[model samples]
Target: MKKIILYLMSAMLMVSLAACTPTQPKMETTPPDPQVMASTGGASDKVPDPNAEPMEIISVYSKNDNKTGLNQAMDAVDKLTAEAMVSKLIEYGVLEEGTKVLKYESADGIGTLDLSAVPQSGSGDDKLTIAAIGNTFIENFELDKLKLLVNGKNYSSGSIKQGDNDYLEYVKNYKEIK
Candidate 1:
């Protein structure tokens, strides 16, 4: 009887341990590659899966071009949701390297995007940067409004604000940067 109780206790402990935050990024690729592992630094919940069927990433905004301010382009992602496509944005140099999407959910036309360690935009183009990130989630998640959060709390930087009245709207006029 004692052995049976000990075994049950051990099983329950193992189950409880599995519910904790993972040590590695939740890349569904079974076998992780070195580049993505180092890039996201386990900050992402969903990473691209090479073995999985890639989905079309609607628009990955980039400011790499000197002439065009913010340009939109398409790419392939492992998953078909905005959460999965966020890693692609990091790869494209849109969101900073350390930026992490902690939680994402939408309902009643409002999408809450919780991030971690978001870099503050000090330049005069904070609106453009906000549009790039907001539109990505808005267009992809099909939300009429966005609530950006940092570390599960409200976020604000430069011209951006995270409050009930500070929701962001979608802007679809970004020219492609080629």
Candidate 2:
């Protein structure tokens, strides 16, 4: 009877030990390639599957050469909409390449476009630049109004304000391609 009780306790302990042992997470069983491991400082990086399909990107339209055309694909969509907008303006050949969009937000049907690192422009360039921005936003995002800022300060445009901020208006000289 003593031997039998010892055997039963041994069986229960074995079962409990098995239950306590942790299971390993599922991972690729293949050993890391020597060349790949060496290139990544002895660590394997997540490599994109060669068979995967390319990601689809949305292309925004812009005015170029006095006619509208397909511009570059959008770099951002939601919160960074102003960055994409400024990029489209650059694509339109109006805004300079180094212009930086600091912030972009929309509230109560009003959109704010804050910019920095923008190049100084003459009156002619400013007109063309504003028109390019206005037409693109109006045509693509259905936004006819916007508050533009340069380096956190309001743009000095006395004639362009609608209510409290400078609003984007349509420019008759900019012709859109059919």
Candidate 3:
């Protein structure tokens, strides 16, 4: 009886030990939805980055210390067209105060933005300024990309410049959805 009790005790101890061991989590091999992935723009959708700019059609996203260009604490406006949105961004100091959109057009998820002025000093400012504008249009229009033109030519400011074939990509994150 003593031996049987001791064996049962050992068995219980082993069972408890086995139960305490960690197991690998089960993973599903389900394929991703093509439409969801495509619509989200896998690269830009990796993170959500809303900035402080007042968003109507779209808000500007400025580069922060982390280069994230996002702030959770921002407000959203409505009813502004794309051109008016850019004007508001200028008011917020994302672009040169006197900058003007020479032309703005978008169709089929592609936007062509022709501007009169862009930030020329401070590489950081230039990058964020361009990023703010491009990101604004991209998010609002659900665009694949924005082709930036300055004074009928490709955009160039500080250390930033776009080639004839180049298009603007998201600044690594997106604005908050209101």
- Judged by whole-model lDDT over C-alpha atoms, candidate 1 comes out at 0.72
Over 4 Å off in model 3, which ranges?
1-57, 63-78, 174-178
Computed on alpha carbons, the lDDT of every model, listed in order, comes to: 0.72, 0.60, 0.71
Residue 175 of model 3, lDDT score: 35
1-178 per-residue lDDT for model 1 (tens digits): 9999999999999988987747776667576766556554464767687887746657676564663467777876667675665676787666777677788888999998887766677553556666677877887777898987778777777765767668878766665322
lDDT minimum window of 10 residues, candidate 3: 67-76
lDDT of 3 by residue, 30-136 (tens): 97877655564557666545754554534555545564354322335656566676666766667767778788888888889888877677555566667777777
Query: Evaluated with TM-score, which candidate comes out highest?
Result: 1
Residue-level lDDT of model 2, residues 1-178, one tens digit each, is 9999999999999999999999998998999977655555433566777987655243444435543533333543443356766775666565778788898777666677777844445434445456656665554555557776777887654333334545775454564323
TM-score of each: 0.60, 0.48, 0.57
- Greater lDDT among 1 and 3 belongs to 1
The TM-score that candidate 1 achieves is 0.60
lDDT of candidate model 3 versus the reference: 0.71
